[model samples]
Target: MKRTLSAAALVLLAVVALPTAANALEGDSYGPGSCNSITPASVARGAAVSYSCSDFWVANQTVSITIDSSAAGVSARTLSTVADAAGDIQVSIDTAADPAGTYTLTATQGTVTDSSDFTVLDPADAAAAAASASDPSAGGNALADTGFAGTALPWVAGGLLAVGAAALGTVVVRRRQQA
Candidate 1:
């Protein structure tokens, strides 16, 4: 009877201890006061090349923004603020005048700073860049280093405690049976 009770307790404990792992879909890499880069700041012939901040950033905070492209000689001279909560920011630049080259997108507000270096490729480039953007590996979070980075003793101790409890229960059951 004691052995059966001990085995049942261990099974129950294991069942309660199990944690549901959060998959990539359920997790949001951008959590609070973080910035992201969106691609292809579009523009017409002479109109200001358009740049945008994501709604994720805009809707989350009222941020100070200055979108400038020295290479294109065009800038977003709006007020010192913009918001992108859905993870988008749109501003315009001189697409016709400036030669095709890489341009920098810098947004700094609060404690977050984000930058994206985009190339002036034909429309074909948009699809490729968009594909790369969609990849989970490309997003901002630390990819190579995740989970259990710093000191990892708590887990070990917990496992040892569970094992000790099982062993003690087994010993008690054996003693009772012998007596």
Candidate 2:
């Protein structure tokens, strides 16, 4: 009984300590930036679109920005800028010369990189897109959905923890009965 309880306690301790240990191993390493988004995700041919990124950048470091499109005859564009003290970046690019298509904007600093996609629309489509963006009921802007909206990982983790607790309780109860 003593051995069983000790083993269970050790297992529980390891489970709780694992996350902390992993965090320690990640010390000072810049993770990839997130909250990468483009405002006015869909734009008319001559409109200006804004790109913004938050977090995960090395402070005050130079960041390389690249805009690439898979559309035929569209050459890639490159620019360089520095991230602010809070590791955030924002830029605007004119879509006047860009053909109607989807473009991906990537920002890289040190080992961290983030990317977002926006669309340059034809005049007719751009009007429709603008209308949709203005109406929240129409689903708002077309920013990438990076949320945990439909993930099952949380449920799985909770189920596992509950199972572990139940198993430990069963072990303790069995030990008490045997005593």
- By TM-score, the best candidate is 2
TM-score for candidate 2, residues paired by index: 0.65
Quality of model 2 by C-alpha lDDT: 0.81
Give RMSD to native, each candidate: 10.4, 5.1
In candidate 2, list every pair of residues with a backbone clash: none
CA error at residue 18 for candidate 2, angstroms: 7.7
- Flag regions of model 2 displaced more than 4 Å: 1-33, 130-148, 152-165, 168-179
Candidate 1 regions off by >4 Å? 1-30, 33-36, 41-50, 58-81, 84-88, 121-179
**lDDT (Cα, tens digit) per residue for candidate 1, span 1-179:** 66767676775576456532423333466354333353334422343454455444545455554434555555543334556546454544444554445556666666766666545544555555666656778663434556666564776577668767876777777778889
Best by lDDT: 2
Error of 2 at 43 (Å): 1.9
